[model samples]
Target: MNAILLILIMIAMGAIIGGATNSLAIKMLFRPYQAVYIKNWRVPFTPGLIPKRRKDMAEQMGRMVVDHLLTPEGMQEKFNERGFQKQVIQILQREAKGWMHSKRSVADLLKQYAGVTDARGKMTAYSEEWIDKKLQMFIYHNQEKSIDEMLPPEWKISAESYFDSFAARIADKGARYFESDAGRVQLETLLEKFLQGKGSVFNFLSSMFGNDKILDKLQPELVRFFRDPSSAMFFKGFIIKEWEKLLDQPVWKAGAQLNTKSVARYSVKALNRELTVLDRLDMPIAEWAPSYEEHIINKWIPELWDQVQPALSAKLLSVFDYLELEDVIRERVDTFSVGRLEAMVLAISGKEFKMITYLGALLGGFIGAFQGLFALFFS
Candidate 1:
């Protein structure tokens, strides 16, 4: 009778105390996250020791993550890690081959990959249209920081180079138009009109391209021509020369408006297109040299930067929010993360949380053993 009674009591005590301890320990981790302020004297370990310390912990974790698991440089180091990306590409190639060998046009696969609705549907958003909200945000939010940090920052490198590049581009453009028949004609018209009237020549070309006035007979050919890098480079050079001459004009020296407003507006439009081009290529902007980047950022990025910052920050935060491991673990306590799963039997960090069962059994066994021993020896 004593043995039976003692066994039941031991089991009850162990069940209650063990559960209490585990709960208390875990609770302590998150409880005191915010510091307590009383009489301007702070309490020791004011709140969640585990999570309250998490700011520093998070910073360290951030650094560690940047260093080991997901650092930009580290990721690049493992670019072909386990050949996963390569294997994916190879699988795609094989699948493509299989599809080719079969009856389907790869167009069907491309449509699926491209998120086309179906064979009957056209793309709602192509490379040019898709926002890549992440990259957009990065470019938008970091515009000022990007300029301050990326530009040479020297008076010559930063300010002078900026204007000089602008002038150089404009002058280079002037050379093209002033020299080329198409460009010379525009300039000749402009000079003649300035000598007498206002934009008597460009007035026609401008009016013709206006949406309601002229159906863009040139739209298809223009889109195709603009897609060529060499063509763009040549025209860009031509425009730059003309721009340089405008900046150097004696009328401006006498304090005429340098017409900076127009230049800035034009730059923003050009950069918007350049960013679209880079997106289509799926190229990283960081790959460009500083000087080359100066041309892009300095010349083209100002107008859209302010509009895009908030959008970018929100998108970046969204991606990070999705990657939060703690939330995932708590939400699905039985599950482990992809990292933990990949490490699998190596860490024995499987989903079973065998520890729950193991701990319960071990503690129960000890409690039972103590009760049995006490009943045998003392009771």
Candidate 2:
């Protein structure tokens, strides 16, 4: 009975020792968050394993996140997901709808970023200054590209057409005038004045040669020529031919002849007229802005997003570099305290560690039983 009791005591001691050892090992992983020092010497297993290697672990985690977990490829795949894109578009549409309906003035929306306010600390009406500045920059950049280069040749109205139209109108008016008796009399008087304006010698020659009679007779012929449709057509064709000759000259030479300052002044005046009409609105901006915004949302956004999808990989790489992704990951990991780290580990594998401790105790009990049997047999 005593021997049996001794064996039980040994088994219990072994089991307790094994369980305590396993528990201590588990505790060692997280205890003593800082290094323990004894004067000039350092204590064994002073700092916990996790605390000792915290920096290395953080760096490894950062690399893992950048390389294997949050890689460019993985991010691009997420961006390409149709469901994800649809969700994003839906969110944008909602926000845009809210913004469009909001009572906030255009200035109110922009004042946060631009800070263009009045003396009362209230947002002022939208200013054309920024628009003017941007437009000037655009014009400066495009100065080298002539207007003709921007417009296709087919879009230009032919010079012949304008000339033909002008000539036809003039000929029609002249025909109407010559068809009247007043026009015939005016022509006779003009010819008479011309003949009399010459010296008396010329008038004597005109009388001797019947030039005065010839001039009186020529009036009806002149009237017929002006009224005739064939003559009218000829004059129109002549004007168009002259216009074509002008058009055939180099465009640059024609442009050089024009006063660019006058052109710019007139263009700006016309644009300002239209813009002023828009500014003094009969209807609310909200009514018209939706149509424009809807156009952008429905047509432009899809096209823009399509373009962005193809370039996402390169853009993601650039963004990651700009964001300092590795350092960000490292910094976030380093911010975790030792207690937080222990909690995170325990959350992951607490049950497994508990099982390890129990297994240690079971193994120790079996070994002690065997030792008891050996002692009983050898004795």
Candidate 3:
């Protein structure tokens, strides 16, 4: 009985010591968050293991996250997942639906979202400036080139045909004019002027014939000359000579004749007037694009997603590199307070830690039982 009592006491003592030691050890893992020192002699294990190695742990965790958990391949896989793609498409469709049905005018949206004060005025100014810049660039680049060089190849190829048509029209109009009463009166007046310019002998001959008679003869001849096909050739030759002279002049001379600022302003105005959509800037989007839900939401969105998904998947690695996610995780983990970190760890494994302490007590009690039996056997 006494032996039995001694064994029980030994087991109890062993159990107590083991449990207490383990509990203390567990507490020490997080307690004494800061280093403890006595007059420059630092106490061993002054700070907890977690606290001491927090930075290194943080760095390891960051590497682990980047290397294993949040790898580019993993991210790309997630992006390619059908469920994720569907979710993204659904979200986009919802946004499109909202905007499509919105009663807000484009001007209002621009003012609200983009901080634009006057959408029309701003667009007009921007267009005018763009046009002016383009015109200036064109003038500067082609200033040294003659108009003939500046003209398109197609225009040069068809130049003769255009000249022929113009000359034929001019001859026909001239012949008609000369056959009219107006042409006869004009001819008589011209004859009078010519006879007056000539000597008295020509003047006497003109008087003998009379201005009316002279004009009657000359007017018919003028009409016939204009009616002749060669007359058209004559006008065409004259026009070709003038056109050649004009084409020989440099582009800068032609540009100098234009009012570029006025041209830009008028061009912008004409564009604004002609582009019927600009007039509807103040109208609600729903009113103008009633089929937006049908076209943009149903058809366009899916097509756009299909095109973008592959490209985005391919670029996930680049995106992750740009983000430097490992450093981000490391910084975040390092910045956590020791107490907070301890609490987090405890929250995850508190039950397991208690079981460890209990196991230590059981193992110590078993060893104590064996020692007590040995001592008893020896006695």
TM value for model 3 = 0.62
Rank all candidate structures by their lDDT, best first, as comma-separated numbers. 3, 2, 1
* Residue pairs with clashing backbones, model 2: none
Question: How do the residues 1-379 of candidate 1 rate in per-residue lDDT, one tens digit apiece?
Answer: 8777777777767766665655555445456556687989887766666445544554555555544665344443444354654554455555433433344333354555875444322322232233344334545565444233433436424443454355445445554544456744554455445445346555666555543233233333433444445554666566566655543444324223434444444554465566643232223223333335444444334334434434554465355557764444344422333333234433553334445444655586577668777767864
- Say which candidate scores most in lDDT: 3
All-Cα superposition RMSD per candidate: 21.5, 8.8, 7.3
Q: How large an RMSD does model 3 have?
A: 7.3
Clashes of each: 21, 0, 0
Better of 2 and 3 by TM-score: 3
Candidate 3 Cα deviation (angstroms), residue 191: 21
lDDT of 2: 0.71
All candidates in order of TM-score, best leading: 3, 2, 1
Model 2 misplaced regions, further than 4 Å? 1-15, 114-151, 158-288, 292-297, 321-324, 361-379
TM-score (all chains, Cα) for each model: 0.29, 0.60, 0.62
lDDT of 2 by residue, 171-244 (tens): 76776776677776776677677788799977887788675476567766776676667776788888866655
Q: Would you list the C-alpha lDDT of every candidate in the order shown?
A: 0.48, 0.71, 0.88
Residue 374 alpha-carbon offset, candidate 1, angstroms: 2.6
